[model samples]
Each structure stands twice: as C-alpha cells, then as structure tokens.
Target: MNGRWAVGLVAGSGTPSERIAAELRRRIVAGELALGARVPSTRRITREWGVAMATATKVLNRLRDEGLVRAVPGVGTVVAGKPAPAAGRSREPQRVSPRASQRMAERMPEQAPEPASRREARPEAESTGARRVRAGGERDLTRERIVATALRVADQEGLTALSMRRVATDLGVATMSLYRHVPGKDDLLRLMMDVAFGEQPLPEPPASDWREGLETVARVQWRIYRRHPWLASTMSFTRPVLAPDAALHTERSIAVLAGRGLSWEEMAQASVALAAFVCGLAVHFEREAQAEQDSGLSAEEWMDRVEGEDHERLTADPERFPMFDAMNRGPEIDLGLEALFEFGMARMLDGIGLLIEQRGGEGGGLARGSANK
Candidate 1:
C-alpha cells in the first residue's frame, strides 16, 4: 500500500511480518495514516512488501486483533482509528472530526468491553482456539457463518491451514465465540464436509445409456473433488463420515444403473469402485498443492527437477528399459491427471459392460459370477 516500487524486494529476516506489522502500527499512531483510510490488501501487501500471502494475511490479522484495522463487509480491511495515545507518544486523546468519525463508525461496529467474569474464567487461547474466536464486540456470530468461513479457509488455503482461530480471525470475531456456534474442530469439519457436499448436489444424469449415465455421474464427482481438492483426502471408504449430501452421490450413481440388469452387489461394487478411483487420483491434487506451498515449487518444476536427474535420464536410455525409452520419446508420455482419470474410467466401464454381456444382460445369478466359470 505504500507505493508500487516495493514489489520485488520481499526478502526479510527473523519474522518480517512482525516488522511490517510494527511499521503499520506506527503509521496508524501518527495520524499520517488517517482514521477510516483504506489499508493495503493482503495481495497488495504480499506483492509490495515482497512477502508471502500468509505473511501478508498475518500482518492484517495482527492489526485486526489489536483493533487497529477492521473488516468492512463489502469494503475491506480499513484503518479502524488512531490507537489511544500511549505514554511518551502523546498526552491528549486523538481527536476525530464528526465526518471522519461517522465514516469510521460505518466501517466498524462499536466495541464492547468483555465482562470481567468471562474474561477471568476463560482458558488461554491455543492455536486450535485461535481461529474460532473474535475479540469482544460487534455481534453477528452464527453457526452458518462460522462453517462457511471455515470452508472458505479450507478451499483457499488448504485444510491443514484451516483452524478455528484462522476462521475467527477472518470473521473478525473472538476465537472462543466460534465454539458457541460449532462445538470443536471435529464438529467444524463435519459441518464443513456436509456443507461442501450439500452446496453442490449432483443433478440427475442425462445420458441415454447406463454406461454413459455412470460416466456422467462419475465425472460430476470428479469435478467436485477437483474443485475442492482437500475433499478427496478427507473421505474414507469404510465407516464413512455420515454426511447426507455426500450420500446423494452414491444414490444418484445407483439410480443411473436402474434397469441395467446389474444386481444389488454389482451396483454397490460399481459405485464404490468409481468413487475409489476418483478419490485416489484426486488426493494427488491436494498433495501437489501442499508440496508447492511447502517447497515453493510447482508440480511441473518439481517434476522437471526429477526428470533432469541421472536416474530419470537413465530410465529413458535405449540400452535399458526399451519400452520406457520408446514411450518417453513421444506425446503418449503425457501424465496429465485428467487423461489418467478418463483412461481408468474407460477400462472400468469396459469390464462392467463385459459382465453385463456375459450374464446375458440379466438372470443367471450374475452377481454370483458365471455358473460355468
């Protein structure tokens, strides 16, 4: 927010975020940064300060916690007001003109002091508790709001980065206040999972044939998993999470196979198989994203590093592993996840088709396998 020239110089030492935060605090205290003035956005801070997004977000969040900057729903993070003049800083109270006060008032809710009893009774805020509570004041805490915020955090920052404290920080509420709506992390996750699935219900399959219908259903699931990469990792095949919206996927899958001559076991097996395949591949999406965040290298960049290695080059040598060597020379070597998904899907459908045909499309205890075999 300072100026455009600071973009590339993001390098720093011991906790640069803290340094940036201190500087902003100073600016707010001085009146050089006016009350109700728009502050730098996290993205602007990241690019301008040469810091990571997390660092930038931390900067804003720290200011919010101190009641220096407040989130204005449709607007954004803005300077809350000059901090109360501290000792040695100034003797008099910082004055605000009526117009400036009104604008600032519109941007922020009035703050209320925490009740003495509750303040003394509360336990220390831990990392898990950090994301959930907003400091005392402003109102508007609801379970729906909390879960939605949690989902947003998971969607944008990955699930590992999501916590009650993080969500509360974004909501501009005390972390402890979130517990009033959602019980705990496990409960939050259950709510988040249900919301994610329920929010995007699968529409009825429009294909004429059963195989096409199955493909349609499977692709819908695949797309949903792709949209929320963290999703695939959270799911389990056995002892499922008991989410009703999520269960709709299986219901739809089975409904598509109605009158397809498949037995109950066959239908269930097919649904599980398709789900397993989609989820197995989709797990890589979150893993790859986490790898990028941790390593600061993209999937292509990491793979390029591998492919440039001696072992990788050795695998392509014609003298050894001839088929791999031959395959490496052409476009067929493409390893796009989408291509792999479709390839696996086609094969699974082919086997299912063969089962239907071999059993004469009905009867013969098809679910029990062929009598001759």
Candidate 2:
C-alpha cells in the first residue's frame, strides 16, 4: 500500500490504527486492492508502518468492522467482495456489553465514553472516568526512555537477564512497542553499549604522553565497567561491536601512539592489547559481583575462610616448591584486583616501552628478528 497517504492522515486521526485502517479502507473502496486480495496482516502492518502489535490488530479489526475485509481459513485476512458503504455513513451502532466495555476501558483509557443519548439507550456502554485515567501512559515513550530503561536493566541484572520484553515491562508498555523504537535486541544492545561508553568520556586534549594516554583510556574504561558491571562481557576482541563512542577510547589510544616512531601495525596492536587487557580484567567485575551476591560473602571474607587451610596445604610440601614458599615467607601479599590491575598495567606498559626502545634499534621493528615472523 502507498504509505504517503497515511502520513497526511496522521494529523487527522482518531488513533494510529484508525489512520491505517482508513488508508486500507480507501484501497478497498477504490478497488486499488482487488476483491479477494490479501490484506496486510498485523505483522506486515507493524513492519511497514512501525506500530505496535496492539495497534496493528486494531487496524485489522477496524477494517473488519467496516465490512471491507474477512478472514479466510488459511490464506489470511482478505478483501471482502462487498459494495462500499457511502462516504460519511457507517453501520448502525452496536450495543456494547458492560463487561466488554469495562475491558475496553482498561486497555484503551484514552477512549471517551459514547454520547449521553447513546449511553441512556445502552447504559452498559458507559465507562466511568475512562477519559481521565491513563490518557498519556505511553505519551513520553521515546527512544531515549527505552534505551535508558534497558541500560538500567542490564546494569542491575546483567546481560543474561536483559531482553526487549524485560525493558518494555519496566517501562509499562507492550513488548512489541519497543520494536517501533529499537529494531531488535541486538540493536538495543549496541545502543546500550554506546551509552555506557559515552557515560565517561576521554579527557579533552588527549594525555600528554602515549603512556599517559593509554593509562587514561584504560582507567576510564575500568571505571565504566565498574559502574556497569555487565558491560565488559559485551566487548569482543575478534568481533568488536562497532559502537562509535566505544571506538573513541581506541581512537585516543592510537592517536597518542602515533608519531612515536612505531610502525602502524605496532600502534594498532598496542592499542588493541591495552584495551583487551582492561576488558579481560573487567570481565571479572560482573562475575565477582554475581558471586558475592549469590554466596553472600565479599571477596575478602571468602578468602579469609579458606586462605589459611589452602596456604598450609600448599606450604606443607614447600620443599617441593621452594620458590613459592620463599615468596610467601614475607608478609601476606595484597591480591586485590585493584592492586593487580595497577601492577599488571605498569608491567605491560614497561614491556611496551621496551618494545619502543627496541624499535629504535638496527632493524626498526626487528631488532632481534622479523617482528612479523
């Protein structure tokens, strides 16, 4: 069907479904849609016009009410070969039962009651205060609202529990309505990731040195992962999610690595390596949080319960592993993730600095042998 006509009718509408039904009614009346022609199903209506399933169903029901269509056993709803009712005329009003009217009021609170004369004739159709309640329940539903709701769900429950339906429930809308805003769950996830990365932006005028720039990017990502524990698992090394905001972290890292007398390949590898390191460690953030919640014990407390026994068992055979015993002979070591991240980052940067020094040697990238092979 031509969708342009529906755009013009949007401002002249009763509801979204009514506008769509009017367009289809025009088609049936004008013979643009031939007799016995298949009418657009609810799925097609949603795909074509980007409306919720409830709205699409209403569209079909409106056409059926107008005697312009009928449902075939298996072929789907089709145009009924009936003469068109004259313009400005409609079928006689059907009396609605109180139970059905109540249900309608519950679902469609925006609908006003029938005229007082009609209600006097059929008191069952009267809906008490229906127009005053829930008139704008979904009026503020925007792409931003959907994305924000999904982000909160993922942050609190992890990616495994985050779904389009879950977000719609949180927003108190139909599940299919979310599809009108976001294409699907994958697209929603991409949006969520972009929002997460954009939350803490890289500083302006990039860090002074390459090391500082990388550290700044890494720490910023760490903080993001810490805030939204589920974000780390969404990151990938082989198949990177192409979120523009997330790429800014890499862009800043690579920019600082530029003009450092390093090869382009080396710069790329270093940038990815730094990001991968941060993400790799950050993966534990959600896992640890989940573990603590499930087991009702913090990391330190859990370790305290088993540390002595494990330590004694390992040291019991210290002679078989002298270096291990020698290292533990000193005061207890701090194995916190923060300390490990700091120490590992310093060591990794030290190694990268060594690579930079070696790159300045005889063979450029291959001071000892070919950097590639």
Candidate 3:
C-alpha cells in the first residue's frame, strides 16, 4: 500500500503478482495488517502497483487461497484469523474436488502439490509450454523483451494482427503477464515505434548541407517504411507519439538546417515538411501489399483483368484523350512505389534546395492575414 511496496512491484525480481501476494501475506502475518483489517481491493492494488486488474485479482486470489485472508458478505477482503463466524454462516470449508485440486496444483505451482487426483479438461493455452515454463520457475521477464516480441509480431503480420495475446503466445506467457511490462497496446506501440526509429539511427549530423541532410533523412525513412510497411501508418506528424528515437530523428533533421540562416520555427517546419511528405507517400506501401496479397494479382494485372471492350476502345481513341493514350502505351511504364518514392524524393529536395538558395532559409511561415470583415 505504501511507496516502499512499489520497489518489488514494478521492476524488482519475481513476478508482480507474486511480489504483491508475498507482501500482503507478510503484513498479515506480522500484524502490520491485523485481523479484521480490510486488505487492499483489486482496484486499489491496480492503482497502487500500476498493474492490471487481472494481476491484482490474482494477488488477492492467492492471498485468499493461502488462508491469509478471507472474503465477507458486507466487509471487503480482510486479514485472516478474524472473530467467529456470524450466526447465519457455516464454518465448514468449501469442498474442492480431486480434479479441481489437481487443477489448482497445476495453477499455483509455487505451492506444494495436493494428493493425486483426477484431471479434468484444460484450456489449450493453459497446458501449453508457456504454462510449463512459468511453472518451472523461469522468472527473467523485462519490458525490453516484451517490446521486442511485440515488434516482431507486427513485422511478420501487420500491425492490425499485433494484439497482446498474440505476443504473449509468442513469448510463452500468460496474456495478463504482459501487463506487468507494458500497460497496454498503445504503450507497446510507442515503444515499438521508438525501437523502429532507433534501428537505422542517423549519423551525428547525417548530412553536410541542408539539401543533403533533408534528402538523407527522407531516404532513410523511406527505407524503414519498406522494411516494416506498417510503420508509416502508425506514425502521425500532427499528433506525434513521444518516442525518444522519433524525437531524435526530428532533432537531426532540424540540426542539419542549422547555420543555413533559417529561424528555429522555419527549421522545424522544414524538418516536419520532409517527414510528412515521406509519410504521405509511404502510407500506400502496406495498402498495396495487402491488396495484392488479398486479390492475388498486381495492380496492372488486376486492371487488365477488369478491362472491358469499352476500356480498350476508349484508350485506342487518340483524339479524345491523346496524352492519356500515349502515356498508357508502354508495358515498361511501370510507375512502381520505389520509382515514385525516388522521383518524389528528388523533386521535394530540389524544391527545398531552391527555397534554401532563394530565401536563405528565412522565416516566411503563414503571414498573419488581416481579419475578415
């Protein structure tokens, strides 16, 4: 309940739920939490320890299971060894079937096993290698591992398929256990984005001049989008996630324009402008791949398949759409993503280079217009 408990709850050794249960057990045993005193509820534990409700529930369940605490009708979860039961209540302990006992043995493996008993059905994931590893006392889990695993899942399958359960399955751990590392998918995505941007770190300056710096940054970002197609769509310039590597990328872009005679605001605009351009074009990277995969045909191939007699006749008429007919003729005229990206990258940098030469990168951001009457 105190800040001291957070030491082991957040990052110290042992699982978060185990650490909490042990702490509460120690408190109750030592009279720090006396009999009849209400222990922290699942909601309270979730808030105090910054763990998920599932983790907190597990802690309370463990405490109740150890007879260190018990639940009352009106009262909340209280310390164990309380006064005699009320008149209407029975003191007899609830029965646990042999199969249930065996299941309990399988679940709470940290405790001693109960007597041999029947085994009922188990969930497919329950008896999995993940459970086995957890049962065997493997305890080296970290936030880095969780983030890395989630990134790998996103890389293989697109970001849409990257749920916490899938990552937990890949890592051979319970879905809730991931909450102990990352709060949720948004936090995990932030970490993943940071890691992705960090993957191809820019040079100290990454460019010699303004033109070269802008080009280099855009090219590097384009390459990353190709590597992880979903990355382009995960990012947003308007509402950027607070990732260190993402910030670093922007910093380097702005830094390259230093001494180019641009104001700080102008430098920021230049950097954001280039990044936004790359992201806009890069957005189509995943969509095209997914489209081709789903339809089993390339864009050109699909067009050919869907082309009708009218389309042929329309294209054959040079007088009606002369420029269109001529431009659409060559089979080699494949305006692929890579080609477009290179072409656009060159043109954008050219425009930026022209701006730098003309304005000397001076401030010209949105001249405040007079109010409309």
Candidate 4:
C-alpha cells in the first residue's frame, strides 16, 4: 500500500484532490485495482490518507466523472469495468513470414546493367504498343474502371485528393471518359457514399429485441464512418440518398422499434433522435481522426495543447470567466464525444424507459376494466 500510495502521490500532485484522484486513476489503469474492487469509502480514504472529507469526495467524484466508478442503489461507489479497447489496438502485431522474405529477394532488381542493344530496343517495343493503344484506347475505357480507380485513389490518398482528372490519369484514360460514369464531382460523391454505405451489412428485419437491433445498426454505421472518415461530412441528413442498402437499414430500424407500442409519430421521432446521436458521434470522431492525421498529434498531445491554451486564457482574464476557472482547477475536463454520447444516450434511454413503463401501466388498467365489463 505504501509503494502504491507513493506512486499515486507522485502522479497526483498539483491540486490536493486532483493528486489523490490521479493516484486512484493510475491504480485503475495500471490494473492494480481490479475492476469491481470496492474503492475505500470517503471517510476511510480521508482518515487513511490524512486528507479532508472534501478532498476524498473530490477524488471519488473524479473517478465517477471518468466512468471508472458507479454507485449502485445499496452499494457505495464501486469500480467500473475497463472500457473496451479502441479499435485496432487489441490485435497482436503481424509478423512477416520467412517464405515471404525469400519471395521478396527473388523479386529484387538485378545489379548488372542490361546490354545497350536491349535497353535501346525496349523503348521502341513499348512505344509501338503505346502508339497502337493511343489510336484505339478511346473505346476501351469504361464507367466501372473509372469508378474503381477513383475508389482506389480515395482509399490511398483520401477523398479530398479524388477528382475526375486524377481518376482518369490513374486509369490511363481521358477525363471526359469518366463523365460517362459520373456526371460531375457531386454525382461521384453521391455514388461513392452509396458504395461505402452499401458495404455495411444490414441486419435482418424484425430483430428479436429493440435494444439489440438498435445497437447493431448503430455499431454498423459507427464502423462505416470510422473507416471512411470523409463519409460523415459527405452524408446528408435532410436528403439522404435513397440507395437500396440505405433504405434497408432504415426499414430494419423502424421494424425493430415497432413493437415498443409507440405511435407512428413517436417512433419516427425516436428513430430520428437515435440516428442524430449516432451521426453526431461519427462526425465528431471523424473530425478528431482527420485532425490527428493532418497534425500528427495524439489525443493526449491535443489535450495538452488545449489545456495550455485554456490556462493562458484564464490567466489573461480571470474576472471574465469565473466558472471556467473554477472548473479548470479540478481534474482535466473531457468534453469529448465519448462523454457526450454516453450522457445523451443514458438520458434518452431513461426517458424512453419511463414512457414504456407508463404505457404498460395504462394498458394494464384498461385490461382490468375490460375484464370487469
């Protein structure tokens, strides 16, 4: 406990309560405090650490704030299970095989130079084929190839670098050839979004449970946006493309929620709310991903920069933002999408749950009246 407390103490410094909270946070992250382990009570922590009750409260609050602890009805604050690891971090590192290394060596360029005659002849041979193709190549280009090349370019350099000319050049075709496939940039974008969204497998209609169905659709959409970071901005809420795959997803979502006894209006409103939550989250995540890709800054690095800027702003105008200053004094405030989504989802579900219960009670009362009649 002393060694652990020492590590915690060193990590905790700055604000008295924050230091205490940090130490506790370290324990949780370090796996020293296993998930579901009962953290010491406020009074016990105060006495054990020789800190005030206020300090202990702050420490617990910080842990709860970070989703590391939960308070059950009868149980005091208890540690929460570790959140699922971020995508792609849980897998083992891929190792190249010895056979692949041997294959690579076999394909390596020769060190010796080719004969002068062969070198001179190679260009002539290639030029003959190029000239023949140039005369007859106009008819060989197709819409599929253009779209396929455009997708490849987007996959490599991102959607921002994609253009008709770029796709045509990649395919060794004229830019006008692409017009047969896509009318313009906007048309290409619509087609591209449809293609990407189509990649998401729609769940079977009439899911066994509403929550399971909603979660499935939400997770699928989330993964799509995660892979295609540009999809968030490209997708339109008001005028979503009525692609078959997209329509199937919408149909499945509605079918699942149909059993909830909600009126058509209520069901539609709830569906919109859920979709908005998922889209908002995807947009936020994509923005962060793009920022990281462009700036080469990790999340922690971005947080550091933000905190530094906030500190400077606070010092420059203490009188203007008293509440912000007070909040800044506490643990690092994370107003990230993860937190926002969790808060919104919990409240939204709670409201829905209450509605369902009330509907059930009303239905039950009507049943009793009918039985009496």
lDDT of 4 at 75: 27
Error of 2 at 351 (Å): 1.7
Please tell me which model should have the higher lDDT, number 2 or number 4.
2
Q: Which residue runs does candidate 1 get wrong by more than 4 Å?
A: 1-138, 205-208, 310-312, 316-320, 362-373
Per-residue lDDT for 362 in model 2? Answer: 22
Off by over 4 Å in 2: 1-135, 361-373
Decide which is better by lDDT, 1 or 2.
2
* Regions more than 4 Å wrong, model 4: 1-144, 155-158, 315-323, 358-373
Worst 10 residues of 3 by lDDT: 364-373
- For candidate 3, give the lDDT of residue 182: 90
In Å, residue 53's CA in model 2 sits off its true spot by: 27
Task: Write the number of the candidate with greater TM-score, choosing between 2 and 4.
Answer: 2
lDDT per residue (tens digit) for residues 256-294 in model 4? 767667777876766667777777777765456545544
- Model 2, span 48-74: residue lDDT tens: 677777677668655654445654422
State the local distance difference test value for candidate 1: 0.68
Against the reference, the lDDT scores of all candidates come to: 0.68, 0.69, 0.66, 0.59
Candidate 1: worst-modelled 10 consecutive residues by lDDT: 363-372
Candidates in order: C-alpha RMSD to true structure = 11.6, 19.8, 19.9, 21.8
